[model samples]
Target: MDPRKQRSRDRLYAAALELAAEHPIADLTVTQLAGAAGVHRSTFYEHADSPQALVEAALTAELDVLREELLKDRADAATAVAKVTEAVLRHILIHVDLYRRELADGAGGLHAMLSRHFRGTTETLLERGRIDLDVTVEGMPPARVADAAARFLADGTVGIIDGWLRHPSARVEDFLRVYAALLPSWWPHSPAA
Candidate 1:
């Protein structure tokens, strides 16, 4: 796509996410997004196949932002765990509305968001962490460890976020922090020795 068109789509998705923060995705419409973004309706569709598509795009954009930001934020050995944990915690805090709204209706929104971003990203994080924790982790292959960690984190964390969303006003930080502590416990040495 042309640079100008790419920027327009980016703006439209940005508008869509901003709107989604205040309202449920089900409540949002193309017209509202187009107006908020100052782009034509046709132009909005050029960026995404639908409003949900826009959500997906917006989230994917955030994931890229997070990947760069989190990885660059720190690179030390002992710190990566805390870094990933804190990154996820802070992310949920910032987007609590969006997260809660996603889970309001039996977690349909949660499912969508997972399919959109966290699933693959979780796997990637697991693999990366495993590689980094080589001395602490022993001999597991990166793919297996990554796959397990991804599945474990995605499933359990999604459920926890759903609960937090259901409550809406609760502080989930401590809850997520403890959960983060469990992650490194999976390191092979912790289990074998």
Candidate 2:
């Protein structure tokens, strides 16, 4: 990555985060984002196809760091899982308003992107034998089972987070409790347990 290009991307990401905190990503225009980023519209296009795409890229990059930490070879899987999960929850809490606005209309682009990200991360962990499925359906192939498990975990977790974000009285601890209760007993850790 060229230094100039990297700087431009950083500017765009920072601006996107700031603007997203104020308005829904779907309502944001490329021209507004480029102006906020202090970059030309052409430069914005060089980085992302749309304002939503830019915001998704910027947010997911932050989540990817925690995913990497969760994937590392730690001695205590439970502790590592708890730490990473808490970190991720804290990250979401920090941007709660942006998430609330994006998810207000139900399963939209941000929700789908989050589901895909979670599903991909789960699949990678499964492939590396970092996690195990506690239940298996009769006559189901291992590959299909893995895929189903990934989708289930991804969709269910995202759904729970979506509901939590929408609820007026929802607290981080309450969300964590529900999240921990919903996980399989075989899961490495429970943040609220």
**Which structure among the candidates has the greatest TM-score?**
2
Cα-based lDDT for every prediction: 0.66, 0.85
Q: Tens digit of lDDT per residue, candidate 2, span 20-128?
A: 9998888899999999999999999999999999999999988999889888846466677777777877888888889888877766787888898888888887787
Leading candidate by lDDT: 2
Clashing pairs in 2: none
Off by over 4 Å in 1: 72-74, 126-149, 181-184, 187-193
Query: Number of clashing residue pairs in every model?
Result: 0, 0
lDDT by residue (1-193, candidate 1, tens digit) is 8999988987897798789889888788899899999999999878877787787678767656765665565455335535555566566677778877777665565565654455665555555653343322469776675666556666666666666567646565656554555554443212111
In model 2, the Cα lDDT at residue 153 comes to 86
